[model samples]
Target: MRVAACLMTLCIPAVSLLAAGCPDTGASYDDFAARYDKINPGTTVASGPSQCETPLGSDMEATGNWLFTLSVKLNPKKAFVLSAAVTAEMQDDGSMLVDMSLQPLSATDQTTPVCGATIEFTDLPVAPDGSFAWVLAPNETPLSLCGEANPISMSEILTGLQIAGTICGPADAPFACGTVTGIVEAPLPDFDLTGSSFTMQKALTDGSFPPPVLNCERAPADF
Candidate 1:
């Protein structure tokens, strides 16, 4: 399988400012916009740059296991509620194919299979702090839209917010060339933490036409 790896980490507080129904100060977006300008730093907006091209396939591979450490503050004193590690197998078809056997650690101390839309190459980007930013969009399914399932995951609620973007790179590049990362935040819900980091180091492999066969026997049978 064609493999390319990217690393990400994000630290966020467990409280929800929006859930409490507070107005946004555009803090997150403003920070992102600042970084975007710093990287692109040009007057004309750098149109038609090779990095903006779509990936050849939908699968995204990883050179090593992707890890995330979440520290939650349960009370005003800032206590540790939980931490987790999620592993994904990059498929040739460009999906962040989940191992299924892997589960998320919980603040509630429950083990649940992490499922849903697969992570894509477009999802990773480098934040200001050099950590990998994992962006998630609100699921638009009938159940989700109807409030049957919460738009954001409970884990995400405890963590920081996610933002989505397009992956761009050379059209003829061997691997799907793009970036991915995450931003860290203070424990306070409404406050924006400065100096968050994101980093990415992709391991590119040769692309094959028919795609290589994946060893998915270890994945959950029901998935």
Candidate 2:
């Protein structure tokens, strides 16, 4: 009986630990979606100013009117990393166009081109509550500004953005998986443009899932 009791004591703690690691999935999507909507209101896009030629390196100076935002969530006190790439276009009608995509760099052990740094998971995680923000910079690279045909600088500048969320326990844990949420804002410059525009989308997909287009714009300046 004493031996049986000892075994039970060990099993009890193990079971409790297992329970603590499991996360709840009911509020997962809704929580993340709400945060996304808050940051990226559909009507933030608008028209602004025109582009002036820079004197130094013949660079075009342009600004944006709207802000972009993105949020994510993870569980089990594990690491979650993100990388994104954006593409812009000048519409024939004179509006600005943009495209954006995000990829998980360290969460699932995937490799990508934009994985600049790995976000380490901490006991005091920021997911589900805090977010990281960065601004969408001007197309510093030749490829960003001129597309595939023109290759200018090696570095690109992104502007006005934040990524925030929580890293909770595992899926099966009682503490529940933490959520990561935030926004990425990219404003546009103005011009006497008609149809010139751009689209912004996220590059990362869940695991091996197919890539998805998060946002798009044909006439950002018209918004």
Best by lDDT: 1
lDDT for model 2 comes to 0.21
Q: After superposition, how far is residue 107 of candidate 1 from its true place, in Å?
A: 6.5
How big is the positional error of residue 17 in model 1, measured in Å on the Cα after superposition? 14
**TM-score, each model?**
0.26, 0.20
**Residue 64 CA error for candidate 1 (Å)?**
8.0
For residues 1-223, could you state the per-residue lDDT of candidate 2 as single tens digits?
Answer: 0000111111111112111221222233234344445554541111011111211111011111112222111111221223433333434433323333333332223233233321211111111111111112111100011111111122221221222221112222101111122221111222111211212222212323222212121111110
**Model 1, range 1-223, lDDT digits (tens) per residue?**
1111221112111332112221232344344445544543551111201233344232232322222222221321111111112234443433443221112323232222233322222223232211222332111100011111111224233233332222222323322112212232322234332222211112223421211111111111110
TM-score of 2: 0.20
- Candidate 2 deviant stretches above 4 angstroms: 1-157, 163-210, 213-223
Candidate 1 — which residues are off by over 4 angstroms?
1-31, 35-65, 70-103, 106-134, 137-187, 198-223
